[model samples]
Target: MQKKNQLLLVVLCLILFGTLNGFGQKNQKNNENTNLKTSPKLVVGIVVDQMRYDYLTRFWNHFDEGGFKRLVNEGFNCKNNHFNYAPTSTGPGHTSVYTGAAPATHGVIGNNWYDKEAGISVYCASDDRYTSVGTASEAGKMSPHRMNVTTITDELRLHTQMRGKTVAVALKDRGAVLPGGHTANAAYWFHGADEGDWITSTYYMQELPKWVNDFNASDAVEKYKKPWNTAKVINTYLESGSDNNTYEGLFETEKTPTFPHSTPNLLDKKKDFEIIKYTPYGNRITTDFALAAIEGEDLGKDEATDFLAISYSSTDYIGHKFGVNSKEVQDTYIQLDVDLQNLLNTLDRKVGKDEYTVFLTADHGAIDVPAYLSDQKIPAGYFVYDSIKPKFNAFLQYKFGTANVVKNFSNYQFFLDHKVIKNMDIEVAKVQETIANELLNYKGIDRVYTGHQMMQNNYTKGIPYILQNGYNQKRSGDVLVVLKPGVISYPRTGSTHGSPQIYDTHVPLLFYGKGIRKGSMVNRTEIPDIAPTIATLLGIAFPNGTTGEPIAEVLE
Candidate 1:
């Protein structure tokens, strides 16, 4: 009986040990599963138009902790980021950032390019195949049809099996449409003036969502009726030029370009809401709308990763009107810093402090006003298209026996009338060489490459490489010209971009949040690399036409 009782006790002890072991193993598996997630709940991409890399350093002291500084201190900062191609305009810039390819591969050669076959200027985002969804204006008749490859946003949607949602917003149509890609749930741009509404095209949806309608119905534009002024103490704006300067372009109603400009005062002249774009209030409205999107769309709410692409276009508008050194430009960056802080705060509250990933970059940087550079004893001058166009046509006429042989000289390239050249029985390659040779003699022209040269040889460095990355064989022109450094084809007052110069190519690139390393890199990185880096962070496929390799340092 005693032996039987001892055996029963031993059996009971064995059963208890087995139960405890099973429970411990289950807990260990649960913890390991939680640690294995490779993707964030959401990705936010912010592109500030016409923002130079110097702007970050110029405004560094004025920036608050949560905006640019937050991105720099706690995030990975790529200080040497630049655009790898020429003609770094908005369309190509944004497309390159998202497609991981230059204009050559992605096919957004310029904001507007002369279509050689079509014999007409083609806007990059326009598509007559679809109608406007929100308003009856031509602004909504835009899509991503011009882009030849998939964007990172498009890849995310596919990786998630269509469960991930992508929504893009901007003041300019191309800014929103290109980044949104072919499969975006919606892409909206604001139409200012008498009809101030956020609009989209039928390519995404047939009607504006109820939330978008509600936003439009509200007095969102009305709140910005106050006059524009500096965000901080005006005296502290030592980083910029005087408030009144001849280098800055004036509003139609005003003579002197100074501070505290009135958007409403200028509204009477145009009778359109377009005047607001010239002020910092444009960025504010954009931030407000972005916040609304986060709430309305319920982003970052579930397992499926979402994406929000927001482009701040007012910087470009203001930079075009007021030179990069003007007080107004300085004021705009200060205001933008605050808006970014608000955006980051909202992400923390809505998406959790570490649940989302955010990257801030620029479409392209702008050159200093050529006039200003001249005054400062720098080598700068204007490349007037008005004067150069007629001469170029005359040369073509003199050589080919007819001016009609050239369709147009657009995006610093000559779109030769191919049919006309074939009809005249002239060798097209000979025509390209003859025209390219003559362009070198023009005052501002630095060098010229024929279509044949662009197609045959691959360039590795200098201006030739930059231009090569921008050239598209089927879509580009016959003769491509590169203006000398500090030479621009724009008016004297405001600055412009679209050069291989450092001022035009260098722009800020920052990555922060979930799965990103906290560090800084000063090595050379191009804008096209952004898309692949994001792809790596999200553990997704690279863009279809990607020519850039991902920055391994950015990944965790």
Candidate 2:
């Protein structure tokens, strides 16, 4: 009886230990699943239009701890970043970022350019065959049909055989269409003449998705109408120049380009929302749409990787209108900091800390207003277009008599009527050289390189700094013109970008979250490197025709 009782106690002890062991294993399994669900498989790419490097430091105090500050403190900040090509406009900027290639390869030279093949100026993303799926007018018709190379987003979708979702959101059509790549699930951009509404092109869908349509119809624009005031006191914006400067572009409702603007009158107009493009609130609207997209699409939910390309376009619009040193510019950065903080917090809640990765960069930076430079006793001056236009025409008239040699010269590219040149039997090369030589002699002019020369000269040296940084053979001008220091192409109303100057080419690049090293890199980095870095992070192949290497400092 004693032996039997001892045996029974031993059996009971074994049973209790087994039950506890099973519960411990089950708890461990639950924790692992939770971690897997929270962390994203890949990345989110955020490109801010016309975001200069200095803006980060300029408005650092106003940034929230969770937003811009989190990115800076936690992420690998590329202190010296820039575009490698001339004409740092929206199309090339977006193309370069995703393709990991410059305009020379990606082929989006400018926003609107004269198509030598069609003998007419063409919009970069415009597709006449496809009408706007979300809006009534064809003006909203745009796609990535013109893009020549695959984007990082395209590669991710391809890796998953189109099962993974890829989405892009921006205020500008090209901003959405290009970065999302050709195979994106959808690319939505802002629409509406008076009240901005987000819309998508037929390239991705037959109609606005139910979620997007609902979001737009909700009338979110009313939230901004509460009040329009500067984020801080006007006098506090001492970093910026005088408010009533002559070079600043006029806002739709505000007179004299001064602060303390009221929006009641502007909002009364049919296209009042257009003004939002020039305000920091535009970034807020864009972020709101982006969050809706993440939730509606269920991005990063499954095992497959997803991609989200978001371009905040208001910075570009505001930079163009207010110049770099206006009170408006300062306010925009401060508000943007706050908006970024809100965005980061949302991402943290939705995606979880370190679960998703983000890369914040710029399409391009801005140049200081030439007038401001001139006031500072710098040898600054505006591009003498009026003076050069007549000279160019005269040179053309002499070369091709009785022919319209000049169709148009804008966006730093000269479009010659090739039909006229062919019929007149004019020497195109000689005519281009003559024009180039003439322009090179003008004030504030640097060296000029014909397109042929740029293509052929593999070892050209002593090239003007601007030309060296800005030139891309295929899509760039037939004759590349470089400006002397402090000289801008656009004469009036604030600053312009398109030169290879440090002010325009230099931009900030910060990569934080998941696998990025915590440190700064001063090594020269171009926008093209962004795509390859993302591709490496996801373990995907580099973009086809990529000339840039992955940024080594940030990668494993």
Candidate 3:
């Protein structure tokens, strides 16, 4: 009996010892995790308007080591990244990035689409019901009310019970409003020239914050008046076409599309700050405002994460004015590269080097000048919608006995008048079919799909799939049109984007700073994947209408 008792005591001691040892290992693992941050203190989303993926490659040698190169080398690059929907324009592109859904779900079909109920074309961000808060002018009369769903920023705010704040800044109204989402603390846009100021709508606040007022009052914008010039010698711009070419559009008062052009000459007697949109100075001022917002808003100052959405709108205006292959366009990008370097350096000082995450992308990519492509034996041409619209209306009148049945036409979509069709005793589906068939017979028209087809069928690939992704049942037009490859509805000079083609859909997607994997991915990725990746990193719920899955390789 004494021997058995001694054996039982030894077994109990051994079991107790094993239990303590297991807990010791578990406690040590928990201690190590204290040093590993699950989320960054802040997130900076940079959307460069009209930036193409090829710009990173073509301007690589010209880029500074600290800017685009740093983001690509020290961070992760989605090389085959693209916007997943058709009609890749500014409003829809920005909406898709933050919403984690396509325009079909978000309800921003185009920058300006025909509003059948409103009986007029509606701008994506324009909301006349809201008053201007920061400016007396109508420039601030805009909000993100058109978006039908939540964004990643909105989800962040909800996850923290409104402890997380978001501030959005851009040169264009839609640029600021859409990315800021519905729950943002502030969304500001620059309205310049005579005023030389930033503005916001009443949707976020009743008045501009004191810091924004002080920043606007300062002479910061005066520094950018130093004439627009090339960052390097003119001869170094060999990647672009000739300095003087017919493909590029000229300034109002200028004759050539060359650089070193007077910034003042571009502006008239009113000294309208509007010309700034066409210059690299616009990007500099936008960065300045964004930095001000960071300090004024006290972003990244606490444990809760904050968000800053900065959109470089000048790049889009410049790309539209100078086309893709011009010395002016090349110089703007180089200057933009420098501005981005300054921004990153500031982030390091204001927010710790590893405390913030950055994602740089573009709203959309522009196509090369169609005329220029034609000269190179490329199969490209212009589809003049203005001239063709009148003739198409006449054709509709001949077939349907009334042109009034077509209520509106924009974004290559045809909106029919249901009331008029009902009065004419015509079936709406029949009208859609007739219009779709007629559009297909037109030159430069590749394919046309009726809204009925999109509602009844699920397209898995090709242009039909993209159009379906962009189609909204209540807001979209009855008939959707697709242009042939390399065809654009634009002037001979300059460039435009609003296509499912790779040139417009392809844009840069770079991830940097904390919680980002340092590598490059040649595998395909889409714009909608951005918000979900951000949601995954933040350990928060994805946007309410999210249709995209997070890229598994993008996070650390």
Candidate 4:
């Protein structure tokens, strides 16, 4: 009886020991998979306006070691990165980047859209509730209220219980506001020649900080008035076409769009500060503001991870004034490379090398000059909606016996007068179809997707799929228009981009610094992958509306 009792005791002891050992192993595995021991001190997101993936390659030989080359050689390069949706404008692109969602979910269809409910046009970041906090201009009336979903910045703020700071700076309001997300500590944008200062809306703070006030007090804009010249020899710009092309727009101060133009010549008498943005010096001032924010805000000093979002808007302005393949555009990029190097050096000193993570990308890429394409015998041309809108209204008037049925036409979308249609007892779907069919008859228009069709299958494939991803029920138009590849709706000179083609979709994405692997990824990746990758690195939940999967290879 004693031996049997001892055997039972031994069995019970063994069982208990096995159970506790198993529990310990399980907890250890959980900790290893999650709860990463450390995160980067700061996350710097640099967005260059109108940057195409090819730019990095086209100007590869000219780039320095610390600028684009440092990010490409020492960092992870996403060679196949692209924007996933159509109508890739500044507002939608920036919102999509930080939200990890498309415009359909983020509610930023374009830079500007016709509001059916308000019966007027609405700016993407404009809000009447918020007034300017730093300046006494109408510029303060902008906020991120239009954003329908949370961004990665918002996720960081929530995870850290609002301890982590998020700040953004840009030359344009939308460029600054959209990427900072809703919970940013401050989002600053350039206020123009009159104020010549970095300004923020009341949505951020009741007043500007002392550092910002002092920075604004400095005559930064005036300092760049010396003159604009090429960083390299004029003949070395072989990648770009000859200067003085018809595709380039001349500045107010110059007779020809040539080299060595005076910066003061470009400044408006009343709004001389506006000329700063037209030159590459605008990017310099923007970089200075970002550096100031870093020091003034103590971005990387704390235990919690912070984010500094910077967007260089001069590229877009320069691209719009001069075609993609001009000496001016080439020179702007060359100068921009130096500016990037300067910012990186500042980060190295302030945040420490490898202490922060940096991701450089673009809001949207631009298409080549339409006139240049035509000169090359390519099937490219401009589609002027001004002419087509009047004709379409006449067609609708003839068919429905009514005039002014089209309320608005912009962003390749049509806004019909719903109130008038309802009052006249006209079938909304039929009218939409009629307009879509009429639009198909116009030149450079590839296809048209009516609202009803989008609702049917959610446009799950092909061009319609791209259109649907950009459409929002409350904000989008009744019909979506797709242009033929290489065609635009802008003037004969300069260039623009708002298409689903490779020219507008393909953009450069480079991830550098902490928790990132060094190498190149050839696999196709979209813009939405960025925010989730950052979240994964931080060991935090992805942004609330994230539809993108983290690139497992990028995380350490």
State every prediction's TM-score relative to the real structure. Answer: 0.93, 0.88, 0.94, 0.94
Let me know the TM-score candidate 1 reaches against the reference structure.
0.93
Q: After superposition, how far is residue 117 of candidate 4 from its true place, in Å?
A: 0.5
In candidate 3, the residue pairs with backbone N, CA or C atoms under 3 Å apart (3 or more residues apart, or in different chains) clash, namely 193-272, 193-273
* Residue 138 of model 4, lDDT score: 88
lDDT (Cα, tens digit) per residue for candidate 4, span 446-497: 9988887776775555677778888787788888888998889888778689
Candidate 2 colliding pairs, count: 4
Question: Model 2, 1-556: lDDT tens per residue?
Answer: 9999999999998998888888889998996666445435547899889888998887787667877888889888898887877777888888889999877788888887767666677888988777786777675677898888898889888877888899999999999999998899999888747646888777788988888888888867667653457888877777888888787987565677886666556767654577667777788899899889888888867778888889999888888888988888888887887777877777777776676789999888888888887788877888777876676667666766742766767676665665676777767676667778877777778766676666555642243433443455544567767778688877577767877667877888999887687888888887889888877777678888587788989964
Give lDDT tens digits, candidate 3, residues 1-556. 9999999999999999999999998988885565345588899999999999999999889999999999999999999998888779999999999999999899999999988898998899999889988778888888899999999999999999999999999999999999999999999999985787998999989988899999988988767766788889989989998988999888777778776777786565558888888899999999899988889999998988999999999999989988999888888889889988998998899988889999999999999999999999999998888767778889978997878888888898888989988988878899899889988888999999999998999998888888899999999999998898889998899999999988999999999998899999999998999999999888889999999989989897
Give the whole-model CA lDDT for all candidates, comma-separated. Answer: 0.91, 0.78, 0.91, 0.88
Clashes of each: 2, 4, 2, 2
Better of 1 and 4 by TM-score: 4
Q: Candidate 4: misplaced stretches above 4 Å?
A: 1-35, 268-271, 423-426
**C-alpha lDDT of candidate 4 relative to the true structure:** 0.88
Worst 10 residues of 3 by lDDT: 30-39
